[model samples]
Target: MDLELQTERLTLTPCTDETLLTYSTNGYKLGPHIGMYLEELKKDASALGWGVWLVIDKQTNNIIGDIGFKGKPDNEKSVEVGYGIISTKQNKGYATEALKCIIEWAFNSDSVNKITAECLVDNIPSVKVLQKLNMTKIKNDNHMLYWQLNK
Candidate 1:
């Protein structure tokens, strides 16, 4: 795993089972109700080859959040990037930094070409990140807006 991605103010690395559990349950305990989904993520990571990772601040080495692609790509068309920042770290631009790093890696990888992200239509903050990345809004299926990144 390429766990040592160094950004201007952040360091990125893959998450372990214990750390992932802590992140998810802690995130859930605070907000977004994410605890129910942590197990599924753990199971999938165990069975699949890739999983989310931590974005650490360089100055403090504190974990900001987890971000990465999960599951197999559909017919190898595109890989989905999933991410979440700790409550205290939100709105400070850390997610964008981590996301750009991961997306750059995905695009450079042999298995992926285009990239995709799904966010609730009402999730304004996430939508802004995609926009900042220059992802196009292709369509909305149910309540999820599908955003795409392709060159």
Candidate 2:
């Protein structure tokens, strides 16, 4: 299988019908919600290179989480990102490394000028990941904070 990105400890695998089905059947530990999102991505042709990717732990070859764009870059050449790591896997720095790899992959495209993300204001860990990556806080609403990083 072709990998979308790789870091020192993780391999980011693109979501495809075959891969999702195999992971589901083999009990590879990808969380429940991810399947639904991958199914949705299968319905959109443009999502081929812009959907979620499975995060694989190199040493254990375990499915720890997923990370990827919400969709393809928008008209403004900005893309939004989302990710999740299983509860047991949180705070291990996997999310941060996976995000950095994905960001680099996104910026490799000539059309992508910026990456954006948002999280509930109380989600401190997620906010910290954005901050650690040097994404600037662009705005805040009653319950959410928005951030962006330009290439």
Candidate 3:
């Protein structure tokens, strides 16, 4: 199914081949990781919602960042969520808002029951965003902290 997760100020557009082509044809400079996402999509059409989703600002109609799952949920029905916003757009609650929308979208799927994430230990902003989502700190290594939320 074609999906566009929406929030108050953002639209999370899944990075399907068609969507990526449309964005590129429209002169949007995609991130390098988008190529990898495209390759995965080429291998499996089911990867549509499991890869990068462009975070678009509803007002300015510009891409503010990207956020989405790394892959489909595993055997345990758990998936990892990741996101990043442009420095200029950071700290405006866009990450939290966009993530909340996607989280709700994911929970609506029977394939997903748990969502997880990881951030560098020193990345206070990301930590705050995950905390704002009410995700619990599950574990941490020397450099990264892991978090989780159950549906």
Candidate 4:
């Protein structure tokens, strides 16, 4: 599915092969980690339906980052979400708005019972984002914090 999610200040477009290639090859402002995500999309069939998405600044009309599910929901009807914003776009609450939009979309599906996320424990901003979304701190390890929001 070609999914495009819009928030108050951003537009999130699903990362298709053509778009990913263009962003990776050209001097687009996306992060380098996107290449790995592109490879994962290529290898996973589920990614075609619910994978990487490009985050755009609606006001500037520039791609600021990306957010998406790791894959389709599991047998447990749960799925994991991940996101990133370029350094220039951080601290604007754009990530939070985009996440709220995506979470709403995911939960709207009957197949989804819960949404999950993991972030570096030391990344206070990301931790705050997860907390702002009301996702419970389900677990944590030496380096990462795991969060979940049940529908």
Candidate 5:
């Protein structure tokens, strides 16, 4: 995957097996969930753009966090997005900026017509990010708030 999304202050790099291995070798700790995503990619090469994208801070040239979809778009052409920023990077607009870039990229694809996201009810910052993206609140269940934005 040669795809890279650039923002004013961030660079979004889609993760591949080689990139993940390189990052790990350089001491970037990937969580277990990320490992699962890697396994998914290994099983299906087409999962590239649909999996994790590392969030790199432009100034520092360091991975500050990650943001991406859980998988490819479904039959309805809808995909779910998820994101995280390091505690030190939280409260900054990085999540919003990165997500905005990725959303545009996804919507530009003919395979994707809608983007969905979910966050814990108590996650105020996540709620604000979704609201800023103009994703409508669609459901609330099991303490999770589901949101969707149609292209």
Candidate 6:
């Protein structure tokens, strides 16, 4: 949404091309993960008022990471929630905190029915983050683990 959402320490807003470019640079240091599709994130913001946003610390306002839903998934009416916390900020519970906000928003939106996500099976931290959100594991393929939050 054009609005801002807050967690105890983070804020979420719609992702834009400006933010996407910023995300690419910030995300690289966080993980080797391929990164978000700029065009797709724009599509989400335009069509749904929801897309990945720069995660800013409430106290520091530092762009520590990003978290939000993308518009592509095999499932209809479903969006995939994705996140990346800077490696420097990793293990501080930021990923889990960011994820909790995104997941709750998805479940509450009429535009989105189910929220799904995937992680490299070897990404132990990500797996735990999803579990903490109560997202159930639904499949594993090609070394990727898939989970869904259906409300």
lDDT top scorer: 5
Q: Which parts of model 5 have CA positions greater than 4 angstroms off?
A: 21-28
Candidate 5 local Cα displacement, residue 17, angstroms: 3.1
**How well is each residue in 52-91 modelled by candidate 1, as lDDT tens digits?**
5577777665666777776556685577788888878799
Candidates 4 and 6 compared by TM-score, better number:
4
TM-score per model over all chains: 0.76, 0.86, 0.91, 0.84, 0.92, 0.78
> Is candidate 5 or 6 superior in lDDT?
5
Instruction: Give Cα distance to truth, residue 84, candidate 2, Å.
Output: 0.8
lDDT of 2 by residue, 1-151 (tens): 2355779998888877666654532334655656766777767766766777888888777777888888889999999999888777899999999999988888887768999999999999999999999999999998999999999
Runs off by more than 4 Å, candidate 4: 20-33, 36-46
lDDT by candidate, in order shown: 0.71, 0.82, 0.86, 0.81, 0.88, 0.72
Superposition TM-score, candidate 5 onto the true structure: 0.92
- Indicate whether candidate 1 or candidate 5 has the larger TM-score: 5
Can you write out model 5's per-residue Cα lDDT over 1-151, one digit (the tens) per residue?
2488899999888877766554432334677768898889888989988989998887777788899999999999999999988888889999999999999999988899999999999999999999999999999999999999999
Estimate the TM-score for candidate 3. 0.91
Clashing pairs in model 6, backbone N/Cα/C closer than 3 A: 1-49
List where candidate 3 sits over 4 angstroms from the true fold: 21-29
Model 5 residue-pair collision total: 0
Q: After superposition, how far is residue 137 of candidate 1 from its true place, in Å?
A: 0.6
Off by over 4 Å in 2: 1-3, 21-37
Q: Which window of ten consecutive residues has the lowest lDDT sum in model 1?
A: 27-36
Question: Relative to the unseen true structure, what is the C-alpha lDDT of residue 7 in candidate 1, on a scale of 0 to 100?
Answer: 81
- Worst 10-residue lDDT window for candidate 3 reads 20-29
The digit string of per-residue lDDT tens for model 3 on 109-148 reads: 8899999999999999999999999999999998999999
lDDT of 6 by residue, 38-68 (tens): 5554444454345556677777666788777
Q: State the displacement of the C-alpha of residue 39, model 1, in Å, after optimal TM-score superposition.
A: 8.6
Q: How many steric overlaps does candidate 2 have?
A: 0
Q: After superposition, how far is residue 1 of candidate 5 from its true place, in Å?
A: 8.2
Q: What local lDDT does model 3 show for residue 38?
A: 88
